[model samples]
Target: MTLRRRILILATAVVLLGAVGVFAVLRASSRAAEKDRAQDGGPRVTRGEVALAPGDGGRRIVFRNMAWGPHRDELATVAADVPEGPRTASGVNCLRFHSAAGTGICLRADRGGVAESHRAVVLDAHLEERSSHPLAGIPTRARVSPGGRLAAWTVFVGGDSYAGTNFSTRTSILDLRTGRLDASLEDFAIRKDGKEYRNADVNFWGVTFAADERTFYATLATDGKTHLVRGDVVERTVTTLRENLECPSLSPDGTRLVFKKRVPGLPAEAPWRLFALDLASMRETPLAEERSVDDQVVWSDDRTVVYSLPGDFGADLYALPADGGGVPKRLMPSALAPAFLD
Candidate 1:
């Protein structure tokens, strides 16, 4: 071959190698960004800001702003015309129970490098930070009382597998009116089968409060069984009422309990069926949503139930009739952990 041709061939090979190197670096960067979005619960460029619509009276829907990307640690409202609200502390993974009374609670997780830490931050109704408490594990759920006088949350501890397989949960409650904190239900006196029992494996999660503020309901799990327990905030006592309930949410009228019940013979990944229990009659009625829901159901009104279902892009909120015979309807796209503002 001619010397000039040989030189040109070598130069072409060098250019091709450089192009391949650049392409590989770009691909790796894209993957890293995706991982960060998943861990931070932030928004992507394609997912636009959550559109807001005026609600009844001054009420609005407040939820995590996935469109805010890395800055999406705090909650945002659909009421775009309202004054700017408070922002959450850095690394907030979830926000819950934003109330019209001007108060809410959020869960922040710091997963930087090899160390991980979690926190629960209290916010005023305007979205201003109030208090922050150090938490022990990854946050799974959060809630505020009917009048916004109380706040509660659940976290997963022990290890990642333990949380992933539903092996352990740590639930805490705070009285915003009094600034008192019940760090965990394990500290409360518990009664099982109408008798007091002391067991180390007891775990509690899914707290739902009544209008009275002092009376609440939660799920207590131990000895491979889960029970619905009514608790007294003032007395710090929990009495087991029934079994097979997880993540119970009270209806707006305080007359019914919407909760997840584990269905036997199902795969471990999706074992729960949503049901509404009449508080007065104690009759359990299965809702029309047949899919297994892992969320703590939210009551949109006296007769409508809302919950989140995982999707390809993000979790979406869906509503169904609480009366047990209606089809599920989508409420919000790319949203989870819904709170109705008053």
Candidate 2:
């Protein structure tokens, strides 16, 4: 071979090897990005734009915003301070607040890559994890009792009915202090119309604890009808209270209950209206927020109620008067599952 031709062939081989190295590097980077997204629940976003800062220790609020991507786990102030959307608990997809004790319940899902298995993680007042419990089904709700000694959660289980109007949920309550778990409400004795009732198709969800940790209110669905029932942890008994109520949240004062009630003539997708039921009078008063609120309402104070509404990018927290008047005010943008730290 000529010396020039030999040199040309060597140079061509070197260039081909360099190209192969670049391609390998690109593939590795792409895989790393995918892993980050999986861990963070979504893509990362720039801070100081749609992010809120974690405020001082006292009376803080924490929420999740999938739109914030890596900063989806966020902390803010009860006064609606700019949230510090830091990357805390990167694996927690859902979270809720225990206002009285200043703790939280965080949920993490492991579906191989999608959502299949879930774990209920207990978070301390400072947003640090304490313990986690393995759970079945997709996580939908998590709540801590007023004293924070007990925690409960609900997950949708069985069938593709969640995509449609009908669905089933398996709600569990954990005694945080003793680590005792009531895996399913189905095991509890239920009384309807002052008589013991047993049904295999019965399901319960959306539990709100009373001042006494042993007593709670939850939605019980059976035989194609939904009813609000008051349950006792000690007695392991549930008694039906009323009909057509879902996701009841007890008032901070313990005199009223805020929940979602189905309103006729609305589309099934957005069929609920926020209503306050007086415990003494049993009168249901509709709140001023006209939009469909598909959340368990939280009491910001005795006079104001807070909840999340879905937005274009993510869900935002909104607060309105608890007395059924006044417009709903936006509390935090790109935040959901508002839990006030007291």
> What lDDT does the true structure give each of the candidates?
0.75, 0.74
Candidate 2: regions farther than 4 A off: 1-58, 73-100, 111-116, 159-165
lDDT of 2 by residue, 111-219 (tens): 6965467788887755567888887777778888878888889888765432244677999988888888899999999999899999987989889998888989999
What is candidate 1's lDDT per residue for 46-97, written digit by digit as tens? 2223222233546566776544355453454543223122222223345444
Candidate 2's clash total is 6
User: What's the residue-level lDDT of 4 in candidate 2?
Assistant: 100
TM-score per model over all chains:
0.77, 0.77
Error of 2 at 166 (Å): 3.4
Displacement of residue 224 (Cα, Å) in model 1 is 0.4
